[model samples]
Target: MSQADACLRLNGVTNKNITISNNVLYCGSQLSIKATNDLTGASVYNNAVNGSISATGIQSCGTFAISNNVFINATANNFYPAAGSPLINNGANPFYQALYDYNGMSRSLATPTVGAYEYSTTNNSGCATTDNFKCGSSTASVPQYSLIS
Candidate 1:
């Protein structure tokens, strides 16, 4: 997949809450926003992708959380670079924070960063500030898995 393509795309038109969880999105070349407004709330977790991914536009506006996600550029072409790719810590806007790092560590940024994995500032094994694994206040466990191999 190229950086010009978006495997999963979401655009909000109203000031409402949006939640996305336990989904598998592959080859996404563009941006992915969990929620787009103050009344919005998005959760992304346990999903796997084979290309660059990003989440933005969720700062003080509402709740935008990305957790337990695995994104890799398995393509042989390596169409995008690490720095220029959308997988960077903060590609579009710096409003989205990283609740968990790539190493499964608990962390958060001073400002919201980009990508699915957030660098953990504290410990690797702890509760994430955004809580991407769980959707909203519900305790019901919803598990999903996507295999690319």
Candidate 2:
């Protein structure tokens, strides 16, 4: 990762043994994974993103791959994949897969989906958002703030 003020969020970085997995990161189109210090054991896998993954950093013992165009309405704030989405079963074994997604839905351990949310064949309502965020069944906007004098 470049040590510049970019529009990406990567913290607590080290030379080795770092994991960045199971995320739906909207890291623009100029995103990449680089290891300048000959980094090893970097796990970057099972992600549905519009970026690139390079194994140029991992010397050995790590998973690094990228699945492209794996969303139905990513740009529309609906990160859920359609029925025929490649993200359905394109992910490798997650580092530590959670039992549920951001929406608190059960996840498939055998055939894990990429990103924070899993593809739900039972639900076709799509991810509806409000104020650029996803809430249960609905969303909220017009953030309330107070000025402390």
Candidate 3:
């Protein structure tokens, strides 16, 4: 997989708006999404990839944002977030909800997790007594047990 070609390749594109989300990509050395120059607008969100992503001259159309993406280390030719991972509920509301994750599980509009699959388990050990979650200087107010089914 290290010497494999790009998973998704777009070369010499112009005046195009690209959006890549809610997918799991695993590779050894191949790039996940490779876009050449002249990209007008792009939104790369809510994706889990084990390899790198490269885009040249990508412009921001105000709505252009890259958030909620997870780059995890590959293990045994697979990439997956562990249980009780901080990736849960770390994602913000996207421009459009895909309605489901890579696993075809329903995804909520509020407090979406960062990655391909929505974490179906919640880490209640470090959470506040209420629905709030705190981490050092950051205080995130997420739905209680939202990760759980």
**Residue 123 local lDDT, model 2:** 49
> Where is model 2 more than 4 Å wrong at Cα?
1-12, 32-38, 53-56, 59-69, 122-127, 136-149
Which parts of model 3 have CA positions greater than 4 angstroms off?
A: 1-3, 46-48, 58-80, 122-149
Clashing pairs in 3: none
Regions of candidate 1 where Cα sits further than 4 Å from its true position: 1-6, 9-15, 19-73, 76-98, 111-113, 119-149
What lDDT does the true structure give each of the candidates?
0.36, 0.56, 0.51
Candidate 3 lDDT by residue in tens digits, 39-78? 4466655555556667664333211223222323333222
Residue-level lDDT tens digits of model 1 in 1-149: 34345656454436334444323344444443332333224433333345444445433422233332322232332212233333334322233333444334443444223444442332223222233332234443323323359
How well does candidate 1 score on lDDT at residue 137?
A: 41
Candidate 2's displacement at residue 116, Å, is 2.0
Q: How many Å off is the CA of 114 in candidate 1?
A: 1.6
Sort the predicted structures by TM-score, highest score first. Answer: 2, 3, 1
Top model number, TM-score: 2
Per-structure clash totals for the candidates = 14, 0, 0
Q: List the residue pairs that clash in candidate 2.
A: none
Q: Please write out the lDDT profile of model 2 over residues 1-149, one tens digit for every residue.
A: 56532223444446466666665545566654433344445666555445554435543323333354556655666667666766676666756766766656677888877666677763435346545457644543322323359
Winner on TM-score between 2 and 3 is 2
